[model samples]
Target: MTTHHPTQTTTVQTIFRFLLGGALILAGTSHLTWARTEFLAQVPQWVPLNGDLVVVLSGIVEILLGLSLIFLARQRVLVGWVVATFFVLVFPGNIAQYLNHTDAFGLNSDLARGIRLLFQPVLVAWALWSTGAWAAWRRNK
Candidate 1:
């Protein structure tokens, strides 16, 4: 059996995960405070709930996702799924921002928002790797 050396990858992954998690937490916290209006403006008109409530709920979810990313190791698969699901769920918000000509995460231009959208898949990949799904993929292939 070949032993997998997760040392380097783990170090890099831990650093990335920590940063990503911290960023999300900060973003989520703002939804509860300073940036609430900005987040509300981005909410699609089609969503059934009150915009403020939605923002708060989304903030809660993001906080949970961030916490899970930082604290949940053995349940990495679950964490990965949460991150992936969050990405999918928030995609429409991104599209809405693009359609309404609004800035994303305080970005200045449509081009910046468009560029940031490209990272969703990369984040999904990172979530998967954080869960060791990449290792499984390599081993299976």
Candidate 2:
């Protein structure tokens, strides 16, 4: 089997990471003001946190994660880890919404909601992989 250089792999992964971060930044911006309330509606009742607090916290985190990926080039490894962790941390909110049948940002759905639940893991994987996190672990071993 042919082998790839570590630098080449790192470059490709960095591009993917930037793209994903940009997308998330945009997604997060969509929820800042009026969108915040709309997004808050999707949070399930089972979540113990106050709805407003959740909205604020989620927005801030999305922005931070996006910014870290874009600006923290030297610390890519840490950024990757943080992004991956954030995804995992927020996943329950998605699941809670799915389970509760709550409207998400007022989006109309037809299996889209369920589709989103599946998509979350894919997103998590993308963030992890694009940040070279899987590769990093291999190296540290």
The best candidate in terms of lDDT: 1
Worst 10 residues of 2 by lDDT: 2-11
lDDT of each: 0.77, 0.76
Q: How many residue pairs clash in each candidate?
A: 0, 0
**Candidate 1 residue lDDT tens string, 1-141:** 968753224677777777767877998999999999888867998999999999999998889888887887666556766787787888888778777878646766888778867887887787767666566556667
All candidates: TM-score: 0.82, 0.83
With candidate 2 superimposed using the best TM-score fit, by how many Å does residue 9's alpha carbon deviate from the native?
A: 4.7
Q: For model 1, state the Cα shift of residue 3 in Å.
A: 3.3
Quote the lDDT for 114 in model 1.
83
Model 2 lDDT at residue 135 = 76
